[model samples]
Target chain A: MLGKVNHIAIAVPDLVQATAAYRDTLGARVSQSQALPEHGVTVVFVELPNTKVELLEPLGADSPIAAFLAKNPDGGMHHICYEVEDILDARDQLKAAGARVLGNGEPKIGAHGKPVLFLHPKDFFGTLIELEQL
Target chain B: MLGKVNHIAIAVPDLVQATAAYRDTLGARVSQSQALPEHGVTVVFVELPNTKVELLEPLGADSPIAAFLAKNPDGGMHHICYEVEDILDARDQLKAAGARVLGNGEPKIGAHGKPVLFLHPKDFFGTLIELEQL
Candidate 1:
């Protein structure tokens, strides 16, 4: 049910510094920072040869990543996303296997405009997993 | 300088349970556990289409991930590895750019038998980065 890695999300305190670190220091192509009010975070994509590294910053006061950044002040890896063929089927299978899905077990349109669902970290070795419909 | 994402490492407290979560629950092809005493970790590779997810468990008392697991008992994302063409050049460039490489600033043979160097997480938005020579 898990396909290619969609992206690795890293929540950072500052987007500009993080973007410059990836673009200038790391020598990677980075996209412009785009704010997603719905998701409550601003994101920049660091394009790698095979996958993407997403730099995220809290957008609003109630941003989902605010609490994470508060605990990890320097920021840290927030979640790992994997592409799935059928997200509903994947969610059902994961649920049947006693895996907990986040947000009422409903798939929401993600940053990439694709249906995505987050799985509880405790169920997957403390790794927050995001399943995005491919 | 950086190429494909080599793999994302997740430090886990229990290898068997983590392996079962990835294999049985997540439905991903997972490799047999391999103990790397030199690196002080046992690993299981979750084969993704574009990249791999490395599940790391402390091998011995002096395991590098021991402190990390102690801090995060439930396990967590340890590091992100990116492939590079020339590791020495990459290290030199990263050093010149003010990024501190871990250890004595020399490349060590990683678990995959490739020369790898770890960068200080503090300088990279709190993300431990590993650069492996491809």
Candidate 2:
């Protein structure tokens, strides 16, 4: 079963401008930015009392967010992550229920250093979902 | 100041299929479907322990989701909502900081029966954000 939302990620064309909107304008506390080359993204976490919002930008031309940014240009809400008790159990349950898990069907260490897996958008009505084990 | 996230909205083409996937497959508790004609959309709320996911489908051909669906046939994540303690203060602060509040910059009663307003996607890194007064 899914727990509370872990973080909602937004694919942004410019991370600085995007992060400023939350940090400078909204006055929300934000975490230091981290670049994850493995994921091909530069991430910044905006802290909220209840949950977090992750801002992601393409690390390079070959980055996956590049494709998304190409279509959106201005960037947009990319995906949402929900917490689960067990990554393997959640994956198995989701797979049995006909949901397609992304990657090699195994959970990888996400930005939070937790095992996370992405679900196919098609199976989720076109919304890409990430399951993070807490 | 923004409170916890209230809900993330997804524009769906088929409410029945979308709601069923969440209810049957994901096992998330869902609320009864409600159609808001003035907004020209039908909405359903998927209850998560910490937050909610709202699914929106065009009530008719003229519905707002119709245009979005035309662009994205599979449906997709539409917008995300953040709870604010005082909407007027939040709106003014956001406006002063140069954020574009969608529509007439006036809050409307959303499906949750709370005052809500949408921020333009352009000003917020292409993510349409909803500010809700809790």
Candidate 3:
């Protein structure tokens, strides 16, 4: 059902600034930073012992984060990622339980080459959820 | 700075049904369930590898979750809990970064004897964030 918390995503207008803010204020360092043009954003990760905080900054106007920020510019959380043992099984289970699946009907390689699936926010409330298999 | 992810909270209306849904769908079991009268809600946690999914249900008319669910009843996510080395230090850091603090100016004993603090949702876009230290 649930395995681990892979990451917590925080939407930001600027990754560099946010990363610096996190570092200077909390001593948390960015372990990795990369741009996912496909997702229209650049993400910087602050790794912790068991979880990581992901800073997501929009790369372009059409990016999802940009649209989200337009609606709520203060920048909020994007999604909660859960590490699952079997993603397909979990997706099926969620579907059977009346939750809508936003995945491409299959698992795909996501950031860090992990298999991932996204559930529609409409079904989960207003929060988007990502399921990743480690 | 940061230690781990204490939990990933999900807001649901019916804990028993959601718990059953998660268990049957993913083989994930509820590690613990309790009601926080102060918070006016009941929480059920599904343990995972590095994190957990907390299902929250409103307990009364003035409950926070009840208001949240009223806006989005399908039930999505609530907040992301991060494990920190020091709650006060984390709060100060976030405050220094111009983030608003929602705690009562001190860490309080939370579920399982952990010290917890909350940050204001206005500063975090619309997402409520909880900081906990083990």
Candidate 4:
């Protein structure tokens, strides 16, 4: 159902602080920040040897990260992404097992320009699970 | 400061159910369960080609996972482990940069038999970060 962890998403109240911590302090190779208007968040990828870490900041008031930051304030781990060979197959299987696929139960293009779907946090034991087609 | 993600730990109220979800439903290779009395948690590793997922259940009433599950109810992503080239170097740099290392600021042998230290969740934007010496 899940291939590998594509990236772990962290929601930060301050993108500059988050970026500096990972890039300058952690000495991780970070990509330039990219704003995803569709997702209503700006993101930067911290490249690791085996995987990547995604730092997300709210783009607008309506951004979901805005709500997350409202509660967390200091920011926190938002969600995790897992790569799947075929997202449709994964979704079908997970749904059959009573997992709730979010957002109209359809896959949408994600930051990597790949098909992705979100599973409800309740279904995933309080962890928002993202499945990306690799 | 960090090498690669060692594993993602999820605090589950029931380890058997969590193991079944990952192994039986998701079809991932799982290792035998192990109890870490020092950490007060029972754990199992879900092996993936790229990395591993650690399922944690409270081993005692005072277990940290017990409190986490009490709040979340359905369980949730607990902490993330990142591998480090040198534990001392990583700790010194993180401390110098104003990050708080948890529990006496010393490394302890983790489930993988590697030197590990936890960074304060507050310093890490509400995300508990574990650094393992690779």
How much DockQ does model 4 earn? 0.73
Chain A, candidate 2, TM-score of 0.94
Q: Give residue B60's error in model 1 in angstroms.
A: 1.0
What does candidate 3's lDDT look like per residue over A56-128, in tens digits? Answer: 8888657867877887677777887878888888888888777887846688887768889988776554667
Chain A only: TM-score of every candidate? 0.98, 0.94, 0.90, 0.96
What is each candidate's DockQ, to 2 decimals? 0.92, 0.77, 0.53, 0.73
lDDT of each: 0.96, 0.88, 0.76, 0.87
CAPRI verdict (incorrect, acceptable, medium, high) for model 2: medium
Backbone clashes in candidate 3 total 6
Compare the candidates by TM-score and give the number of the best one.
Answer: 1
> In candidate 4, which residue ranges exceed 4 Å CA deviation?
none
Q: Of 1 and 3, which scores higher on DockQ?
A: 1
lDDT of 4: 0.87
Q: Model 3, which residues run further than 4 Å from truth?
A: A89-98, B89-99, B122-127
TM-score for candidate 2: 0.94
**TM-score for predicted model 4 compared with the true structure:** 0.95
* lDDT string, candidate 4, A84-125, tens digits: 899888888888888788989989998889999998887667
TM-score of chain B of 1: 0.98
Q: lDDT rank, highest first?
A: 1, 2, 4, 3
TM-score for each candidate, following the candidate numbering: 0.99, 0.94, 0.84, 0.95
Q: Pick the candidate with the highest DockQ.
A: 1
DockQ of candidate 2 (2 decimals):
0.77
Question: Which lDDT tens digits does candidate 2 get at residues B9-128?
Answer: 999889999999988877788999998987889999998888889999998658867878899999999988898999999999999999888889999997678999998888888888
Write model 1 residue lDDT over B58-105, tens digit each, in one string: 997799999999999999999999999999999999999999999999
Interface RMSD, per-candidate values to 1 decimal: 0.6, 1.2, 3.0, 1.3
